[model samples]
Target: MNREKLMKMAGAVRTGGKGSMRRKKKAVHKTTTTDDKRLQSTLKRIGVNAIPAIEEVNIFKDDIVIQFLNPKVQASIAANTWVVSGSPQTKKLQDLLPGIINQLGPDNLDNLRRLAEQFQKQAPGEVATQEDDDEVPELVAGETFEAAANEAPSS
Candidate 1:
C-alpha cells in the first residue's frame, strides 16, 4: 500500500483498531431523593453545628432505649434542633441492667443490695401490689403502658 495507507493502519493498530474510535458508555447510577438528605441540607442552612467531645448518646422511648456509641452529634440550641447520626442499637431495660449497675459503681450496688434485703425481710411472703389510683401499673418487657392499660380489666 501507499505511505498514507500504511500510516493510517499503523495509527489504528496503535489506537487499538476501529473499536477504540467509538466512545465508551459511562456507568449510570440511579439516585434517589430522601427526606434525610433534605433535612440535613435544611439544617446546614440553619447553622447547625457539630457538638464536640461527645462519647455516647442514649435516647429512651418508654421501655426501649436507643444507644449510639461514638456518634456524630449536631445541635442548634437557638433553633431547638438536635441531630444524632450513627448506627443505633436498641435494647430493653432488662438487657441494660448490667451496664447500669456498673455505672452505679460498687458503693451504690452495696446500698441497693441492703435496701433489697431489708425489703425482703420486711415482707417475706407478700408481694407488693398497688391499690391507689396514683400508682403506676407493672409493665412487662416490650409492653407499652397504653397496651397494658387496654389489657387491664375495666372497673
Candidate 2:
C-alpha cells in the first residue's frame, strides 16, 4: 500500500470504523381533532323539508333510511328519514334507480330531467342553483358535532 492509503485506513479505525454519513431526526406530535369534528357538522345540515320522495331500508346492516329527492338523489341521511314522516313504508332507493345506465337503453334522459324538475317544484330554491354557505355554519372552539346536533330543537 502507498503512504496515503495507509494513513486513510488508520484514520477510519480511530473513528469507530464507520463508512457512511447520516442525519438525525427529531420527533413531532400534533393534536387536531377539532377540524375533523367541524367538517362533519357542516355536512350534517342542508335541507329535507320538501323532499319529493323517500325510501326506507336497512343499510350497512343497520336499520337506516335513505330519503330520495329523485331516483338516486338523497336529501337527508338514511337514519333520519323519519324526520319527514313518522311512518314510511319499507322500501329501497335501489328499487327505483336503474342498476346501470345501459339498462335504460339510452332513452331515459328526458325522464331523468323531468324527475329533477318535479323535485325542484316540490322544493323551490332548495336545489343547487345557489350556494348553501349560510345553511351550514362553522363550529366554535371546544365544540363537537354531536353536542351541537343534540342541542338543536327538533322540527
**What lDDT does each candidate get?**
0.79, 0.51
Q: Give candidate 1's error at residue 129 in angstroms.
A: 14
Task: Report model 1's TM-score to 2 decimal places.
Answer: 0.45
- In candidate 2, what are the lDDT values of residues 1-155, reduced to their tens digit? 79999978667555344564433355776658877666446545643344445443222222233432223223455446423323334445446455423445445766766656756665655554335535664565899989999999999
Candidate of highest TM-score? 1
Q: How many residue pairs clash in each candidate?
A: 0, 1
lDDT of 1 at 45: 90
Q: 41-87 in candidate 1: lDDT tens per residue?
A: 99999889999888788786856989999999999998998999999
For every model shown, what is its TM-score relative to the native structure? 0.45, 0.18
Name the runs in model 1 displaced over 4 angstroms: 1-30, 33-36, 101-155
lDDT of 1: 0.79
